[model samples]
Target chain A: MKDFEALKSIWHDQVALPKVSHEDVLKNLRKTRNGLASKLLIEMIGMGIAAAVLIYVWIASPFTMWTTHLAMIIFICCCIYYILAMISNYRRINYDKLLDKPECYINHLKKYKHDRYIFNTRKYKVYSIFFTAGFILYFIEISFMTSLWITVMGISFTFLWIALCYFVLMRIYIKREEAKLEEMIQNLERLHKQFEDTDQ
Target chain B: MSKEAQFKEIFQANSKKIYHLCYGYTGDDETANDLMQETFMKVWQNLDKFRNQALISTWIYRIAVNTCLSYLRVEKRQAKDELTDTIIETRGEEISEKNEQVSTLYKCIAQLEENERIIITMVLDELPYAEIAEISGISEGNLRVKIHRIKQKLTELYNRHERF
Candidate 1:
């Protein structure tokens, strides 16, 4: 009983709260950037969707009217947005930048596991709904020569997205493997620390 | 409330508990501190997705455990343990007076496999076996059995080291 009491006291006294501050926001931002596989997967899905959207539009009679032209222009703009998203991703990868801004990180990680959902949902968005919708739109605009040209351009851009995704994935895979190796080393180090503490 | 206010409340309430959880796993004050901050930062970032099913404390513990586990993967425990010895030495009287039993308890704890250690820690923190089982994705009955074994082992270890 005395021992139990003593142990409890020690547990309380020795265990102090660690001081964690806002930088953790940045740290997590860094972690997202560090998650290269996820990023690549997202990019690939995005490209695949763009391609399917193009094909769907081609099949659906290709819109050429002034209204269709405007709509196609909007679609192209969305495509450009997707492209810009991909480019930002690449730049992030290149600079080793993590999306660690405090507002974004806190909102994503703590406000609700928003990041996890976003992380999980990104694949579906790129590969399924977005792609399907995009292709259908493209086909509607297909009657327009301008739409055809845009579709062609979109296909080319899709290829670029795929190439970039592949490149990023390869790099991320290597980093992930490296991180795994590092993890193993850390475990061994902890064991060694425990042993040494015992010796002391 | 605005985002900043909400974030601040979470940081204040959970930071210490999160740190202790990390320390319980890492046994390093500084690393545990860093992990605690990281865990909260994650919680803050993912706050919106928290459907109120589980208690906030449970969620925080989950994050702390995962973070510590991942960090452990990269660190060389051997090197850190050596440094831990130095820390223990420097803080000998401070730690020893606190109760050598706790350190002994932790040493044995560190010996358990990762899953076992986590389950036991959750138990020690007074988390119900049901919650433990839920977080671990195991049956409550199984958790009871595992907890019994862990306690038995811990008792045996505590006795073994008590004589020294």
Candidate 2:
């Protein structure tokens, strides 16, 4: 390691040249450029669809039941919170200064995990309840105004949506996020331990 | 020059050096190649915004550094420890004194703080202090101090890991 100059000389000698031709870069750039716009468009379209449904439910809900009105209000509030939190997390991760230390990244990841836990466990539980309640109330009004078939169909749809989201969060997403952080932390910790070992 | 031409020239000039930057951060060929491509894609996209206020090389280096950091955060959580393994296997193909030297340096570098690793690699690549400071987003005075400390740590580790 004291061969610092020798190390530097060796580093300069190595080259990882691109196998792709300039023509390939130009072609890939065009494809990649299209990917950016399409991704933005898709996100906009998806958000538009979600916002349209939520806003419609809030505004055009023709329910005389106090329970129905209350449920809709709760659901709307939940939507607002979800959107705000998503934006907050994105900005928090992106806008923060790139801290140099691996420990700093580990610490940042810890905070991220903490926030995700709250979102998954606490906030999600509350959201599921409010969403289910909202649909149930809305369906009850449907039962009164229309046929039982329509109300049953609405309830079935609501339960299916809730179940899908629940399955995804519990089985797929949370585990994946946790495993990623834990694995990264393990590697980072080992690197730190190497230094400690060297000192000893 | 056309924007495409300008970008090609920039890519031609700095892509290998930037790949080394990515290599230092990732310490693996596959991930380093992925990161290098990502960095240049970003460079091509953001090229028009390069207002000539800073040196093009510094701007590009900053992009590479940030891209590498972000890539580490998202892509492969198991990177650093695997870095030592990568150096041995990747260098085996070349098998020379230079490869031996780089392999050892990379192992020592893996122990430094993530930012410290990037800074020292750039220093070892012999980028000027001003350019390093600009890319590292530190003042030159602070960079000198930081580099001095990192060098001492590297020397200690090298001596300890030295093959008898």
Question: Best candidate, TM-score-wise?
Answer: 2
Least lDDT summed over 10 consecutive residues: which range in candidate 2 chain A?
A93-102
Model 1, A1-200: lDDT tens digits are: 23433444545565443445655655665687468657677776776687568557645854545555555555655566666667654643331111232222222323223332343346424543444454445445453555667778776676566556545764576567556655545554554453233223
Docking tier of model 2: it is acceptable
Best by DockQ: 2
C-alpha lDDT of all candidate models, in order: 0.56, 0.69
Candidate 1 local lDDT, B29-107, one digit each (tens): 6676667766766676567766673476666666665555546434446322222431233354655644455566667
Off by over 4 Å in 2: A18-33, A36-40, A43-130, A146-157, A167-171, A181-200, B73-95, B152-164
Highest lDDT model number: 2
lDDT of 2 by residue, A32-105 (tens): 76886576567656655776787796678666888777776776676676667656654563322332333344
